[model samples]
Target: MTARVGVVTFPGSLDDRDAVRAVRIAGAEPVPLWHADADLKGVDAVVLPGGFSYGDYLRCGAIARFAPVMGELVPAARSGALPVLGICNGFQVLCESHLLPGALTRNRSLHFINREQRLRVESAGTAWTGRYTAGEEITVVLKSGEGRYTADAATLDELERSGRVVVRYTGGAPNGSDRDIAGIANEHGNVVGLMPHPEHAVEALTGPSEDGLGFFTSVLAHLAGTVPAGADRSG
Candidate 1:
């Protein structure tokens, strides 16, 4: 059976369709989930696509984190029962929900940064990154005003020690994120949140490169048991 990946659509989400398309492209069935709906429709995995949820008014994802859909998602994700990937604004939501550590603050320049970004895979063991090799580089589109990832020094050290820092910005930090961190995963490796829009880079014709397809394919591979779970740690 094909793995069904649900893409959640918040009120202001802009990349929900693209995320669904990426899931289909990766040979998984794409299920559309709504922020207000408490049901997941029995999806095997879920993706929170990028967009300015709640107009980014009180903070990027503060409001969306409390949406009805998250009520079910948070518990499943934290318990390692469900795999979840959060992209761009969705990353903010994960942070706001405390599913992932650290918070996304505004870019040091305090301007919207939009461009193709190069990132190095720091961990390939997570449910969303199993297809990538450690140290492999990939390019994905990143567009956000509050994209800088920040956390207390102790928390950063703990994440690094636990091998949860999944990806890092290559060459330089585009948004002044500490240690050039671009992505991270939860302790059980079922949850991942990244600041770049991998769904936007899945198609060659529409995106800068097709490198981002691995993120989707990785999840499928994990579900099939083709990839080992919670073992491959970053060096």
Candidate 2:
């Protein structure tokens, strides 16, 4: 059976459709979940796609954290019953929701950076990154204003110690993120958040490499009980 993947759509979600398409391309059944609903409908995993929700007021992910949908995401993630992946603005929401560590601040230049960028897979044990090898480099689109990630030094130390920093910019910092962190994961590896838009780079005609396909495929690979052999981060 195809793994059921849930993609949540909030009022201002811009990439929900693309996220669903990416899920479908990864060979999963994409379930459309609403931001207002309190149920997951029994999905095996979920993806919070990018977009400016609640107008990024009071912080990007702050308002979405209280959405009824998250009411189901937090504890489910804690118990490992369901896996959650947040992309771009969704990453901000995940952090604000306390599902992941650190906070996203305004980009270092205070300008939105929209371009294809290179990143390295820094961790392999996350719900969304199992298909990648440690230290792998991949190209994906980066577009956001509040993309800088900040955390207390102690938390950064903890993440480094526990191998939780999942993805980092390979060629220096893009947004002045502490440690060039592009993505991070929770302790159980069931939750992941990243600033780049992986869903945007799945097709080769899109200029940026098709390296982003692994993001969605990783979840499916996990469900299939097969670790991808070609997903080496050293590339």
Candidate 3:
């Protein structure tokens, strides 16, 4: 059966359609999920696309974190029964929801920065990154003001020890994130949050590269059971 990935559309979301298109390009059905709807529509996985959700009021994703859809997503994701991918503002929501450690703060430049960023795949064990090999470099578009990832030293250490650091900025940390981190996964590896916009880079015709397609493909592989359990590292 073809996998069905839900692309959520919250108020002020700017990349919902792009995410849906990416899913379709990855050979999966794209289901539209509303932020106000608690139902997931039986999607195999979910993608929270980038945007200025809730008008970026009350701080980036702070308010959107409490959306009705998140109420159901939190528990399901925590149980490892569902896979969730958060991109840019979605990453902010994930941090605010406490599904992932660390918060995305203002850029060191204190301005909205937009660029094509290079990231090294640090962990491929996660549901969203399984298609990538460790050390693989991929380019994705990034646009945000509060994109620096920060966490307590202890938490950062723990994430590193547990192989939860899924991706890191290559060459330099454009947003000044701790340890040059750009993405991370939950303990169960079912939930991932990243500052870059993979959905925007899935198509070669419209993006810097097709490297971002791996993320969507990885989830499909996981749902198909082609990805082995504990098969976390890709050298």
Candidate 4:
């Protein structure tokens, strides 16, 4: 059976459709999930696309973390039964929900940033990165205001030591993120949060390159148990 990937649509979400399209292009079935719904509908994976959920009130993703859908998503993802990818504002949500560590703060420049970005794959063993090779470089769209990923020094060190730092910005830090970190994964590598909008880079005609397609395909491969040899599938 084709893998079913859920693309969640929270209020004010702007990239949910792009996420659904990316999933479909990657050969998986896209299931639309609403923030108010508590059920996951048995999807193999989930994507929280970028957007200003709840008008970015209180704080970016702070309010959306309490969404009814997250009530179900949090536990399942914690158990490593569900692979979740959070992009941009979605990344903020994951951090706010405590599904992933660290918080996304305002850009150091204190301005919204939108541009094509270069990133290096730091760990390709995760469920969402299996299609990539460690050290490979790719270009994807980066657009956000609160995009700086910050964590306590100890937490940041631990993330690096555990090989959970999924990707790092190449060239220079666009948002002044510590250590040029652009994305990270949970200890199990099942949950990944990226500051860039990978869904927007899945198609060459629209994106900087087709580099972002690997993320969706990687999850599908994880579900099918057909990831490349030597892949870490513990998640």
- The model with the greatest TM-score is 1
Stretches of model 3 off by over 4 angstroms after superposition: 228-230, 233-235
Output the number of the lDDT-best candidate.
1
Q: What does candidate 3's lDDT look like per residue over 31-148, in tens digits?
A: 9999999999999999998999999998888999999998889999988889999999899999999999989999998988899999999998989888889889999998989999
* Model 1: per-residue Cα lDDT over 1-235, one tens digit each: 9999999999999999999999999999999999999999899999999998888879999999999999999999999879999999999999999999999999999989999999999999899999999999999998988999999999999999988999999988889999999999999999999999889888889999999999999999999998755877663
lDDT of each: 0.93, 0.86, 0.91, 0.91
Each candidate's clash count: 0, 2, 1, 0
Off by over 4 Å in 1: none
Worst 10 residues of 3 by lDDT: 226-235
lDDT of 2: 0.86
Model 1 lDDT, residue 142, Cα = 84
Give the deviation of candidate 4 from the true structure as CA RMSD. Answer: 2.0
Tens digits of per-residue lDDT for model 4 on 122-206? 8888889999988999999999999999999999999988888998999877899988999999877889999998899998788
Every candidate's CA RMSD: 0.9, 2.8, 1.1, 2.0
TM-score of 1: 0.98
Give a tens-digit lDDT track for model 2, residues 1-235: 9899999999889989989988998889999999999999999889999999888888898999999999988898867657788999899998998888889999999889998889988877766777777878998899999999999999999988888888898777778999999988877777889999889888877538778888899888876767432133222
